[model samples]
Target: MKKPIKDQKMVIFILLSNVFTAFLGIGLIVPVMPSFKDVMELSGSTMGYLVAVYAVSQLIISPFAGRWVDRFGRKKMIILGLLVFSLSELIFGLGTHVSILYLSRILGGISAAFIMPAVTAYVADITTKEDRPKAMGYVSAAISTGFIIGPGIGGFIADYGIRMPFFFAAIISFLAAISSSLILKESLSHEEREQLSSNTTNFFKDLKKSIQPIYLIAFIMVFVLAFGLSAYETVFSLFSDEKFGFTPKDIASIVTISSIVAVIIQILLFGKLIDKLGEKRMIQLCLIIASVLAFVSTVITGFIAVLIVTCFIFLAFDLLRPALTTFLSKTAGNQQGFVAGMNSTYTSLGNFFGPALGGILFDFNIHYPYLFAGIVLIIGLGLTILWKEKSNEVSL
Candidate 1:
């Protein structure tokens, strides 16, 4: 057998690098989506369709994704996922037809199904329970960094051509794949792999047993949070173009600033804060604050005020993500890959519906989606309030 990892930081750094590249690909297209609609002569609903299709594919594959991560090794799966992601971006860049775009999105979704569960489970495997939150924070910070930086670059390069960002995405993802193959060690032990190979049928039964009430609530919360957040993200460019009279670069700038704030909160604030406040309270607080601010954002049209509110919203978002991830990991027990995959499934459900509805609502009234999202977040706040967790319970 290959030797166990001697340097944990090196392994983690490699994982974070791959995460940054993966999310960068996703964020690269966000700024240029409006341009696609104009050039393709597509309606808002069609735009939403394109966004939702990716998540829909994720939804279909996520149940199996977890098993695959455990069954195959994390290193192999991560590298394969990156390869597929780069190919998908290449397809998106080269294709001119709408159907080809759909195909690209499907491929991207499949790539995500492989990437996220494996990455999260890999984190869980390497870190101690006490250290998990901070490690996850580092991971989240990497993703947020990619998101912020991608748009800043994408918006500018997109001036050359809308497809330029896709080519950039392809190049970056390919590099990420090469890095993973060369540098990252597999997280799963050989004993675990042998056990998995012996119990194909029992894996399903174990998965069924792993779904507990707290986990169910955690799943629901992840879905609702992603749903509400997606409404804002999916239509932000269109809404700003119409209401704020902002160009793509302007929209990109605002998002870049918001994203930078998020990165700080995730890396510097999220772990220590979650350790002190506890996951349940953090979720409730972020939901209510984010909800109120999202509503206030609709009424305050001034760019500076909106940006101020956006900072708070981004902070809320950053805080909630790690909190929920820590909470879900606690509930997952030994089935980290399955639980992470389930988490991705719920998130995919939200992503699928959020954009479709947000787009339709945006066409009816630009302000409606934001208002409705705030209302939906309130429902999540209520759910968190009702949840019960035992004192002194540790995930292990």
Candidate 2:
């Protein structure tokens, strides 16, 4: 029989590793997309479509994955998701056709559907309510670190060849899968798993019952944040190339710098920021700041101006992300995987609309995506205002 596992830190480490691995693979592509488009002879809309398809696939899979993570156990789902993530990156490296890119996105989306909830649920399982925020801080830090660092690293690797980063990302993901399989223990007990199976026999029923107003608002906020950011991503490289005549490496540098700012906020300032602003008020402030920055992006003309705005954007985004997630988790209580999955589902919807809309708008005018995101954020801020008196979550 297996010895009873002891340290919670090990569980937290494994979850952090899984998140870092997933995001690193995703981020590696951000800096290299311009090169890929030139090689593939693709347009802005097609690029946006690629991003949208991934979200669409994830949107379809997330709710099911959320329930399944609760049912099948977190460790198994995370390993499977990581393996698929590796396969998606491998496909991206191997493909000469655009169809392969689409296929890879589909796989990536499916992997996200599984991994997001499983890892989130795993974090909840390993920590007490008092410790959950700090645990989540580590989780957010790992994700943001991978996201910001991955772009610069990918750009550097691309000096060898653009496809090289994809191949390398594949290796990184595969290794994460191996390490997790060897070292990570399942969060759910056998009895809990059995009882979960019997109790959650009706997936739709359980999903319906797990609903709450805070969950709904959390979903909407996730959607809004993703929608606004995806617009910037969909068009940033294109915008830089068109307006400022920036190179791929230059765009990578900007992304890397912005991400560094974000990672710093995620790690160093999360609690202090929340404590100082309060979660409810902070959420409102982030939305307003993001909307303003996103709008400011449309009118800015130079590389340095854009870079400064981008850093602030990342900072606001980082603060907003963990704050909203912590708020949602505090409300989620026991059904961590399912609630987290729903969060992913709403995020996927935003992802879908963001890229698709951004791409469509890009074909018309380059600045439209940024303007569009600003509008979305404004709407989100209005909703946040309405949410003020209702969500009385004073402290976290």
Candidate 3:
């Protein structure tokens, strides 16, 4: 007998809670990172490498993590990831040396590689095809809220002590994990489990087959997005301090506002817009907007201009992500874990390269990072045009 449809609202709540913990752990550290570097007497290149290390770890582990999620189930992976994340955050809280900090980031990256894709795959399992985009939007909104609030709270507390943010993040992760363990139900059936377990294909073959053209395009787009964002992150604080005469507090405020705008757009408008405009067009439009705003940000000097341009950039990113996620999940069909894994891999690649390149460019000039990011975004946009044409041709 077919099971009755589960309550969507409850599932979304659980998913959002999961997202909150994930982003809170990551976002809360952003403002304090520069301060941490200053106190530790680290160079810009070291800081960039610190950021890149997370993604590098994720890239290395994602393929195996994906297969494990497919074989073991999303619920298990989520719980395991949370546990790892919580422990890593605790270590980060107690860390005294740069090497320890690097270890913490590596651990967090592994946990993130597992948690993020697993959570999204679980959401895909629960929602119907018609409702998937809306579901993804809500998840994205939850992520955005964390991005907004986490940084603000972290910045406020980091003024008191750097370790405080890490402690709070650990607490949040633990609580979230406990909530998920109690409330989130298993969505996959015995038959699905059997299929996954019985599959005998070689891992490489499964991977190649699982990655369709649309999936590749989506991965590329996400890669570009991550690359650009990471580059900005690598240099934004230095740029503000050196060029704009802004304090760390000011940079934190700017990021907070940007994330707030992102949350509003993702929660209030993204679903309706996706329903009306379709995912492909909305993604393209967002890419164009992000590219323009990125360029504009290069020329702007004041806090207000930074805030305004960042708001637009965040809005575009908010719109772009859910749509891409929806596209990836839909294309994955039954292989949700594999697709999610691929997404994680591409993002990791972006994270690895973005900061490294940004640091290299920053050696020459702070503005070079943003300017290069703007150029890369334009290139991504151009690729989107090719993607569209290819998609149309395939449809015909």
lDDT, candidate 3, 3-108, per-residue tens: 2235556657777787677756655666676677678887777777777887798777766776677688888888888888888889988988989988988888
Q: Candidate 2, which segments miss by more than 4 Å at Cα?
A: 1-8, 147-149, 201-214, 333-338, 389-396
Give the TM-score of each candidate: 0.88, 0.89, 0.86
Model 1 clash number: 0
Query: Which regions of candidate 1 deviate over 4 angstroms?
Result: 1-6, 124-133, 144-150, 186-192, 200-211, 391-396
**Local error of candidate 3 at residue 390 (angstroms):** 7.5
Better of 1 and 3 by lDDT: 1
In model 2, where is the ten-residue run with the lowest total lDDT?
387-396
Residue-level lDDT for 140 in candidate 1: 66
Ranking by TM-score: 2, 1, 3
Each prediction's RMSD to truth: 3.2, 3.5, 3.4
lDDT by residue for model 2 (307-380), tens: 99988987887788878887777676655555555666666787789888987898899889989899999998
Give the per-residue lDDT of model 1 (tens digit) for 144-184. 57644666677777878889888888888888888888877
Deviation (Å) of 137 in candidate 1:
3.7
